[model samples]
Each structure stands twice: as C-alpha cells, then as structure tokens.
Target: MSDSGRRMRTVLHADMDAFFVSVELRRRPELAGQPVVVGGTGNRGVVAAASYEARRFGVHSALPSTVARRRCPHAVFLPGDHTLYSEVSRQVREIFERYTPLVEPLSLDEAFLDVTGARRLFGDGRAIAAQIRAAIADELDLGCSVGVAPNKFLAKLASVEAKPRAHRDRIDPGEGVTVIQPGSEQEFLDPLPVQRLWGVGPATLDKLQRLGVVTVADLRRLDLSVLSTSLGANQARHLAALAVGADDRDVEPDREAKSIGHEETYAQDKHSPAEIRRELIRLIDAVTQRMRKQGVGARTWTLKVRFAGFVTITRSVTTQNTVDESQEIIDLLTPVLAGIDPSPGVRLLGVSGSNLGTPVAQLTFDDVADERPDWHAATDALDEIRDKFGSDAIGRGSSIVGGRIRTIKRGGQQWGPDQPPSREISHEDDATR
Candidate 1:
C-alpha cells in the first residue's frame, strides 16, 4: 500500500512475559529455569503468575496454590512483591513515554503505543519499538515482547504471538517487534482460537463453542446478523470486526482506570468470621495504600467472594464519606459476609474501591496549644518513613495487635509478622467453638 493509503499507522502492544515471576527472576537470577509461582504463600493463598516451567504442569494465575502444588510439586512458590514490581513497571513506562507520549498502559506489564506520529520524532515504528524493548531490558533488566500492527487488535494479537519462551538463550533482537501490515491481519488471526479474542472470556467461549465456533475463522464465517442476534448488537459488531482484523480503536494515551482492587484466594477455604475480618483489614490497608499512592480516593467499597465450587458473588455499598479506615471497611463488610450462606467454604475474598475522587487531605488539631501541626507535613513525614523503612515502619496499633493480618505486595506475594492465616465463616444459627 502507498504511504498515504496506509497512513503509516502503527500500533504497538508491549507486554512483559510472566511479569511478576519475571521481576523476581531479575532480582534473583538463580530462579531462572525453575518453576516459580508468585502469589499468596499462605494456607489460603492463590497463584498469581506461573512461570513457563510451571505452566507445563497446567499451573496458572488465580489457581489456588494448594492445587498448583499438586500440579507442579517442584514449583518454587514466592510471595509477590508489589512494591518491587510497581517500581519496575514504572521504569518500563518511563521508557515508553520517552519514545512517545501516546502510551497507554493496560496494566503493570502491558500497554499500547501509537507510533504513527512518533516516526517523525524518533524513527519508524519498528525502530521505536526496538528502542523501547531495549530500554526495558537494559534499564530494568526485564525482558519484554512487543507487537506492531496497523491497529490495536492486530497489535495485541501480535504481542500474544511474541510472548517469550523459555528456550531462548538470548533475548531475540527485534524479533518481538512483528509487524502485520494492512490487509494481512485477517489471515494472521484466522487460525487462532476464539478465546484469543480480547473480549472472549470463559463464559463467552463456552457459548460460542456450543455453536461450533471454535476458532476465529469459524466466528468470521458466521453472518454478522446472526452474531448480532446471539451476542447483542455492540459486542457482535465488535467481535465481527475483530475476526476480520479490522480494528478502528486508536491508541489511547490517557486510559483512566475504572477501579482499583486487591484479592486473595486461600490455600484452604476459610470458615471463621473473625479470620475473615482480619483478612479484610489487611486488604483495606493494601488498597488504601495503593489509593494514597495514586492520589485518588474512592466512595464505594465492593466485597467479592468465591465459594468452594467457584461460585462468585460481589456486594458493594456506597459510603456517606470517603474514608480509608480499616475499621470502616470491616463494619461495611461484616454484614455482607453474614448474609452469605457459608456452605462450601470461602475460597477467595477481595476488596475494591470505586467512584474515585481527588485524594482528600487529612486535618489534625493541637488542643493544648493554639498551634497545629500541618496535616500535609505530617502525612508527608509518615509517607517518607514508610517508603524508606517499609509499610511496617508505622501502622495503627490495632493493626499491630492483629497479628494474623499480612501485607500483600503488588506482585501477589504475602508477607507479615507471622505466617499468613485463613479465616472461617459459620452459617449456623448457634455455634460455640
């Protein structure tokens, strides 16, 4: 295609392979070639990311660690280090932003960049991607894969195709930066499974499978009207377009996060109310810390639980005010937990804050003297201390007394004063243990 006809529109999807586990390996290279699963390392813990070695045994993220161990007994289980991962992710983003302002981060390890306009500023799309991938590897010592295509869908697919493999001794130089030009995206995507499509989750895949639509080609063969009738107009249209490798979505530079949340799946099902409360407290602390760091406050709290059979439910409540207090979260969550029928046992629990607002500043007054300490100054000091000495450097005395609570790092690792503990919930009307 002519340059003007093609418009030289190049979209890139950059993703770090097994991001959490990769960060750990970068810090301790000895862990290389071993199966590493990063997540909660507790009785009630879940896997966040399974290294390629572990995946060979069918281990994957969000799977209960107990099950993961059964599947890959030799896997090295590491508690996630959120702080370290966050720092590394920041470094990666810095590299992307340096190349182009049109960088959109999907998560800590994945993002998209529109490099069309950047060619004039930097070089061609492939050259910019090479620089970005190189920067991440050199500066952060972390390997990342990049995909380049004419649009977002193809770019994302190209990245997935570029996902790193364990056998590569040296990172491939620019091999990750695969380019799918216009008119070739459809052929490139046809053989892939429908599940590879961005919006095709387990439920949707199951539904599509019922109609014998197992691959992208099959889905593309169906009439658009039939797809619209089955999957609704908007989703059907989007899926149809995606199947043909026609994606009009731009590389969004300013993607806003709709919500922020943290969750944990226990190695063992928790049934104790008190234990559940303790877990909630820990989650509150972690979520609030993230909110503070992001300079955002939330007005709603959502509690998510998954039962033994994988039945999941969510309950949310809007607060009169936005407060990050752990006790407030406890008060709000206790009733919700009480209402659930605790039959099979609780396998997972999560807390999410939404309806975000500008972070509010705290106020404090000195009653004895007609002077008050600057709230901002006090907050800054506390933040500094915590940053330098770690989260445990300062915390509520109540939290200290609650020895069972643990800190969960962004990489899905759990650390605390003691081994992480699981909680139980009882549905019995009268029970004395």
Candidate 2:
C-alpha cells in the first residue's frame, strides 16, 4: 500500500465532469476539444450544460440559449438526451459500490464516499477515489474530480478546487485529486473566503462584511455573540463549527425522493385556451402513466402556469378518490384549468401530482361510470402494447387531435414527455425523475 493509504482519509467527494454534455459527447467524439452545450434548442431554450471550452465564452447552465448564442456563436448546442444520461449514471454508481458501500449520492453526477471503514480491504480513501475515477473513465469514458478530507465540508470544497481551470488562491492542489491532511484541515481552510462556509450566502456575507468577518480565519475569531448578531443564534453556531472545519454529519447511504412530477419550458408563450387544454391533457396522461406504473396514487393535483414576464401561479385540487388515471385526474382539474387567465400568453404550463401513497382500490363514490370494465381493459391493453413495442405504437386521440403535442413515451422506461419539438423534455434530465 502507498504511504497515503497508510493513513486513510475519512471522507471523499467525487463529481462527474459536465455530466449532461459529456454523455452527449460520448456518441459524437468529433466535437472533442470544441465548445459544446446541452439543453432546450428553441429560441428561448435554456442552457443546461456547457463544456469547459464554452465556459471561456461565459456560457453556463440555466443561461438562456439565445444569450448563450450571443455569447458563443460558435458553440454547438444539442437538445439534451436525458434517457442516455440516466443509463450512464446508473453504470457509474454501480462502480462506486464495488469500492465502498458507504457511498451517498449527491446527484446523478456527484457523491460522497466514507472510505474510513474500507482502507484495509481497499487500501485507503485516496486509493478508493482513484480506483472509482479510473474505472469510470475506463468503463464509461468519463472524467471526474475527487477530494479527500477529514469531513464532508472540506471534502466538498476540495472537489470544487480540483475542477479543471479552477483559479488558485490558497490551498491549491494542482490536480483532479486534492487530499487535505487530517490534522491540517484548519490551516488549509483558514485562508479561504467566508463564502467557502456552507451557510454564508450573499445576505449572510453582507451581514458578515458589515462586521470584520471576511475569511474563514476571520470567522474563526468572532465570538458567539458577534456571529449571532451577524446571523441568527442558530446559524451563528452552525457557521462557527464549519469555520473550524468541524462537521459531524455522517455520510448517509440513501437520499430519498420526497415527490415526483413532470414540467416543461416553452420556446414561445402559449395562449389559446383549446391549445393549452390539449397540452394539459397530454401532461396528465404522461404523469398518470408514470404514477400507475410505480403503483402509487395521488390525492392532490396541481396545475402550474407561468406568464411571459415570469409571473407564475399554481392551482391544486383534492379529489375524493386517490387517482392515477388520466381521465380521473383531469376530471377533478378541469374547473381549476378553466379559471386561469391566459390573456397575456402563457410561457409554460405543467401538471403535478403530490400527496402520493400506495395504490388503493377506490370505488369512485359508488358511481357506476367509474367502474366501466371496458375502459379499464382498454387502458391495460394500450399500456401493454406500448411496453412490448415502442411508445409511438399507441396513444390517445386527444394527444394527437391538434398535432401540437409530440414524442409521447407510454412506458416508464423513458423520461421525456410529449411536447412540441422545441419545448420537449425528459424526466431523466432532472434529479426528480
């Protein structure tokens, strides 16, 4: 074992490099060394990921694509392929399990691994991180930055510093790997800016700046009273601990999803009542299919609308029956949908199902129409055919009547929803999916 392995670091943080764009580049290697971006491709589409090459031109995620074009006209923008990205993330995660079972995923592209318990079997924390990164590159053709430290905060900070082209100030590690010695956490963190602490945001920073707090070292000097004055007493205590590189939080192995729903952003605002209603039905169909496939039902349904100026409104309804069918959910939501004022044009519309629970046999208020055997059988048949064939094999006439909504995937295998070409998005693209 290497010397670094003799004294294993306790915590590690690993982040995949430009995950969305990197997955797209795997199939199109010709774009290597060029500025590449992935997101919605419409005029008002947003940038989701930009390559290191594109960052030189000030391109970044969530920046409007039109502005991104204005900033880097030469950059290649591809509509995000979320389905492929999710598969790749699964492969990468399996590799982490091979090294240590104490891995906690931060997102699809990042995770925190506690390797203190695996040193005898895996060498050390640094050795384990290297193995994970190399396996991802060799098996999945990806790059990542890994940081090893005494705790989660410093390890997370180290991973950021390890990113390519990160500006050096102090505590520079000069490679994709940064390992802070166990006893040197304070010395390595002191010279860093106050923002390096987790709780110090712009408002808190302004509050701290009003006093003399600037760097971690400066914060380390402030008494509890001053930090309480700058922030609340509770926040002050939390930041005080972080300032000295003391974090006792364990590396939890699981991060559970609290809710699930689908939403889309449009290239242009949609205003027509009929057009919007059609879109709503498609959204309902998509959300319900996913819900039923997962064997879950929701008591509440919400419709979200956003105007051109970004003024947004959300309306929700509680139904007597726990619902997962498109017709049942839309029946309860119809009145709420009619009340929306689409006058100024709507930029986005979404349907969300919350208050989820295990599937229950509902009698539908003893209504005879609700128990129609023919309709239930037909729905089952369509779902089955779509799974065996492709999603395009079968779809509701309502979804295609106006021909506006496209790309509907019936089975849960896919993450993208049915929408206009420019505004279409897949669930795999988002963490909630």
Candidate 3:
C-alpha cells in the first residue's frame, strides 16, 4: 500500500501491564514472580492493581482488601507509589509524542494514538506500536501491550486481547502486540462473544443470550427494530453499528479535563444532612488544596450526593466570580444541598470545582486595592502553613468540630482504580454572561 493508503489502519492503543504493581515491583524486585497487590491497606480499602500471580488466586483490582487477603494470604501488598507511577506515565507519554501528537489518554495506564500522519516519518502503524513498546521496555523496564487497528474500538479490544487476564487466562503474550489490518475488523470480532462488545454488561449479556444472541456475528444478523425494543433505540443502533465494525471516533489530542472533584463511599450509610454537609466541607478542602497547588481555580462549585440506592446526582452553581475557598464553595452549593432530601440517607458525598481556569470577579477600585489583597494574603498565609505543618495544621472550625475528614491523595485517580457502581448525573449552569 502507498503511504496515503497505509493511513487506513493507523490507530494504536498502548496499555501498561499491571501498572501499580509493576511500578512497585521495580523497587521490590524480591516480590517478582510472586503474588503482589497495590491498593488501600485499610479494612475498607479496595484493590487498585494486582500482579499476574495475584490474579491467578482471584485477587483482582476492585476486590476488597479483606477478600484479597483471604484469597491469597501470602501475597505481598502495598498501598502503592503513585508519584513514581505518574512520573513513569509522563515519560511514556513523551515517547508516544515522539511518534504521534494525536494521543488520547484513557487513564494513567492506557492511551490511544492516531498515527496516520506519522507513517512516512516512522514506518507504519505496526512499526510505531513496536517502537513505542520498545521504548517503554528499554527506558522504564516496564511491560506493555499494544494494539494497531483502523479505529479506537478495535484497537482497545486488540489491546485487551493482547494482555493477561484474571484466573491465569492470557492471550498471545508474545511481544504483547496485536495489529489488525484495515478491512479485517469484522472477521476479528465476529467469533468473540457478544459480551465482549462495548455496553454489553452482565445484565445485557444475559438479555442478549436469552434472545439467542451469543456473538457479534449473531448480533449483526438482527434487525434494528428487534434490538431496539430491548436495548433502547440509541443503544440498539450504536451496538448494531459497532457489530459491523463501524466506528469513526477520532483520537482527541487535546481532551482538556473539565472538572476536578473528590468523593468518598462511607463505611455505613449516613442519614444526617448535617453530617453529609460536614463531609462536603472536608472534601472541599482537599479539592481546593489541589486547585491552589495546580494554580487553577474554578467558576463553579458542585456537590454530589449518592443516595443509599446508588443513585448519584450532582448539582453545580456558577458564581459571579471565581473561588478556591472552602467557605465560598459551601456557600455557593447551599441551594443544591438544601434541595437534596437526605431523609433517605446518603451513601456517598463529594465536592468539586469546575468551569476550569483561574477565578474571575468584577472588582471595583476600592475592593481591588483593599479587600482582594487581604483575602488573598490570608489564604496564601494558610497555604504556607499547610506546606510546613500539613493539611491538618489548618482547618475551618465547622469542619474540625463536625467529623474526621477522610484523607486521600491527588497524585492519581480520586477513587480506586476500579470503576464505581453509582450512576453519576451532572447538572451544570452557564457561567458566562
């Protein structure tokens, strides 16, 4: 194929292998070839990552730490080195940029890279995947899996098939790479079970199987109207399109983060709205601390409430000015807070800052000279004290007397690596005038 024609299959997905455990293994080489897990060491902590050896024992990510211990008592466990992992992920991104700037990160460990423009400069999609994987292995001594295909969907699936899985199941780990030609997507996906298709969760898979849809090939044979009755119109069409190996999503290189937030799943359900608000204040402190640390502010303050039934609803309010203060966030989110009927009890509570960018306010001359300086100076002074003593050194009186704040780091994902079970609905307002 000519260079232009070779562009037909140039998207590549690169994913690290057991990212957290791998990073930890670099320091604790003695644990190599042994079962190891990285996550919270507490009783309520969940698994974030598990080594292949640990996976064979049914110790996998998102499994409660207590259960993981029961499954593999001899496994070595550590909370994890997030700072080092992030640095390694940064280094890996730099390597991807060396081949293609069209890199879309799915998470800290996996990304999709569009290499159409990179073929002439590099070799081809396969060559670029090889080069990137080689760079990660050589420079960081890390194992990674790569998938090269015509689109993101197949690329992601190829990567998944290219790596190891739970219960000692693994695909072709040879070189940890899989490349699908431009027109072979259907053949590659047809034999795979219907459950492997995106959006086919356990419940959906059971529904599909009951309807005699066992594989992609079976799904492709169904009429649109038949599937629509069961899967909704939009989802039915979407799955049908995917079944035919049709996906046009682009590799977004500049997917800016829209918001930053922190939440906690309580050990037990909390019934008091006052208690829920107290947790919100504590969460606001962590979020604002991160905003200040990054020199980013927000024009909107948000609150997330997860009722006991796992229904999560988020409400956000835009302000006339930007803010990075805990008190200010509580004030802005009060209306939303009051609206929530906490009588049913809350399962989780969260706070966030959004409408990213430094806060802005309409300041008159007198306020700009006097009020702004004092407010800024006071917050700055508190920040310095926090840097010296710790986050607990400074606190708001309400938060201090209310309840103990749950402490988690911002160096990585706000929650455990595994996806949460709650359904999140965001309500946003226009801040621009």
Candidate 4:
C-alpha cells in the first residue's frame, strides 16, 4: 500500500526476443548461432526481424532490405512466415492466461499481464516472470524478456532493458527479467536517455536537447514553462509526469480493435489508372475478407493515396448499413479514387474499414430483391472454400488478373516506417490476425 492507501499493482510485460527470426530458427536449428534476417528480399522489402548475430552488423527491423544486404552480406535471409508466427503467438498467450486473466496483448510477440491478483497463487512478480520465461524456453524453445513494474509505462521500459544487446564482438545475454519495486520508479527512470520515453522521436529529442535536457533526470528538473516553450504544453506535461514516474494507467485486457487496414508501397511509382485500380480492388478485397473472418462489418470505408512526392490525401464514405462485401466496398471507393489525380505517380495506396460492428442482415422487399443479391451468403460460401483450400485457391475475378494478385503478408511490422501508413488520415493495419 502507498501513502495514499491505494493497493499497489503488479504489471508484467513479456516481450519475445527477435520474435520473427526466433520462430524461423526453431525449426532450422542449424542456423542457431548464425546471423539471420527475416523479411522480404525485394528492393522495396523491409526487415521484420533480425537475429542478434545479424544486428551486430547493423541489420535491424524496418531497415530497407537492400541496405540490410549491404550491411550483412553473409546473413541468411528468410521471407517471414506470418501464419506460423500467429499460431506460435497464440500458444504464448495461452501461457500468459495460466497466470492471470488480466492480460493485454500489445502485439503478436508482446503482452502486459496484471498479476497483482495472482501474487498469492504464483509467488511475487519476479518469481512469476522467471517461471514464464522458463516455461517458454522449455515448451517453445524461444527467448522472452520480462519486466515487472508498478505501472504499464515503466514495465514496458524494463522489458526493453532486460533484452539482450548485440555488440560488435559478442551478444550480451540480458538479465532475462527485471523488476522495479514500488516507490523506485523515479530512481529507475532517471539515468535512462530521454529518447527512451514514449513519444520522444527525433524532432522531440532535438527540441529537448536545445533545452539542455539529455536524460530523464534533466527533464524532470527543468521548469514546465520552459519545457512547454520547446515542446507543446500537453507534451511537456506528459513527459514531465513520466520523468517523475507518475503514470496511473491500468492494465486493460481484451481491448477491442478500432479498425482494420492494409497498404503497399510500390517498388516503382505507379502512374497508370488501370494499375492503380487493380491495386485498390485488391486492397478492398483483403480488408473485407478480414472483416468477414472477424465477424465484423464496417459502416465507413476509407481510401488512402500517397503520391510520388509523399503528398498524401484520403477519401472516406459512410453508409447506414454495415458492409462486409468486397465488391460493395470497391464500388463505393472506386469513385473516391477516381477523384484523386495520379499523374505525378502514386507511391502507395491503402484501404481500411472503420466504425465496425457485428454485421447485421437487413430485410429486403420483394420489389428490391432483384436489385440486391444475398451477398452475405455468397461470401460465406466463398469463405468456406478458401478456408478448406487456401486464400489464393479462389478469388474475385476483378481482383485477380492474368495470374495471381500480389498481396503483402499481414504481420506485426509494416514495410516503411514502423507507424501506420497514414496516421493522420486512415486507420492502423489490423495486425492482430
């Protein structure tokens, strides 16, 4: 209990070490100590994960595959198997459930578990983290770093601190588990770099640096009025709270996803209207298929267009009835796409669904029956066929061209920046799948 008499919380953040590459290595034990990189090998490919051996040579996730190859010529590269990764991720979640019901998954490879209620059944936070690490090692042969803290923000940072680092000469095996007792949060955060704090990106770092703030301790001592002049008032206050360890967030479990989206950056800029249409249709098909699989429908559909110069624009359409059919979404977004000029060349295109809810069937009058087909039933049948065989076994004719339509894997990482393709304009790619 604290001075305020509130019950202390025990939050545990468990993050898989080199998740994508580690899953790949499980079957190929021969690659154990070798440098391995997993992602697309194409010129436009981005690294999804890299083994510590590969990191020593400066290979890391989100780095362009071309640059990764130049940096680590001897590294073995593998196209990530997202399906396999998802299956393993589920198994990992099951292990977390054995300890606590209040588990919040941050991604396929990491989660936050509120174990304050489970201390009696599973010892303390440190003991629980150790057991989880051992179980994963014993059952999945994978490495996991765990951080136990009093709050979510510090727990996530502690997990990062617990991860092994790759040095030029060798890999330093981390402590595997780090715990911060209550009342010690500020002590733990003081020495860390300010950039380690959430939302402190390159621009924010430069601003803070001009104020002579290099560490969390420095930021903590700086006047709020002074910091606000450099960073905005809201951002300055938020950082100051984190610097002094004043986070009050709880470990929320089973948070519902807000939206689903997908986007692709072309190796070469796409200028042709026909090519852009083909890509748009494919994206619509993918997003709706995901919606049907998840048993949700969207009331709004969003289209994203990024031209060659990186000038981005978005168009959105809303409907009274939820839509989960690919053709319907394509019909709605096609006109929206037509309004945008692609003359300068389109570098990226994206489609997404928002305002999602359980798809409800609307009654049709006999007179209008001829105008509308039972698209729900038709799509359900198609889904069964695809499930029995594979996603590519059957597809809409318009979405498929001469051969197969190119599709990127739905994974934890996206190709370019780690952020959503269009944060200000569209939704994030629903990577939970």
At residue 248, candidate 4 shows an lDDT of: 76
Residue-level lDDT of model 3, residues 1-433, one tens digit each, is 5534533758999999999898888888988989998986655568889998888888888898889999999998787567687888999899999988899998889999999989999998878888888999999989899988988889998888778665555423455888888778889999999988889998888778878999999999988898999888998999998897777888898997788888876655778666666667667778988888877889988788888797989887887777786556766776688888988878778887888887654557987667544556667787899899877776654444324423456643332333332432221221100
Runs in model 2 deviating more than 4 A are 1-9, 166-174, 319-322, 369-378, 401-405, 408-433
| lDDT by residue for model 4 (40-89), tens | 66677799899999999999998989899999999998877778999999
After TM-score superposition, the amount by which residue 285's alpha carbon in candidate 1 deviates from its true location, in angstroms, is 4.0
Which model scores highest in lDDT?
A: 4
Per-residue lDDT, model 2, residue 293, is 80
Backbone clash total for model 4 is 0
Estimate, for each residue in 144-258, the C-alpha lDDT of model 1 and write its tens digit.
Answer: 8889888877888898777755433333333667778777877798899999987999888877887789999999998888877778889888888789877667677887777
Query: Residue 212 CA error for candidate 4 (Å)?
Result: 1.4
On TM-score, the stronger of 2 and 4 is 4
Separate clash counts for every candidate: 15, 2, 0, 0
Candidate 2 lDDT by residue in tens digits, 68-156:
99998999988776667778888888998887788898877889988888878988667878888899999999988899887788899
Judged by whole-model lDDT over C-alpha atoms, candidate 3 comes out at 0.78
- What lDDT would candidate 4 get against the real structure? 0.84
Off by over 4 Å in 4: 1-7, 361-372, 401-409, 416-433
**Ten contiguous residues minimizing lDDT sum, candidate 3:** 424-433
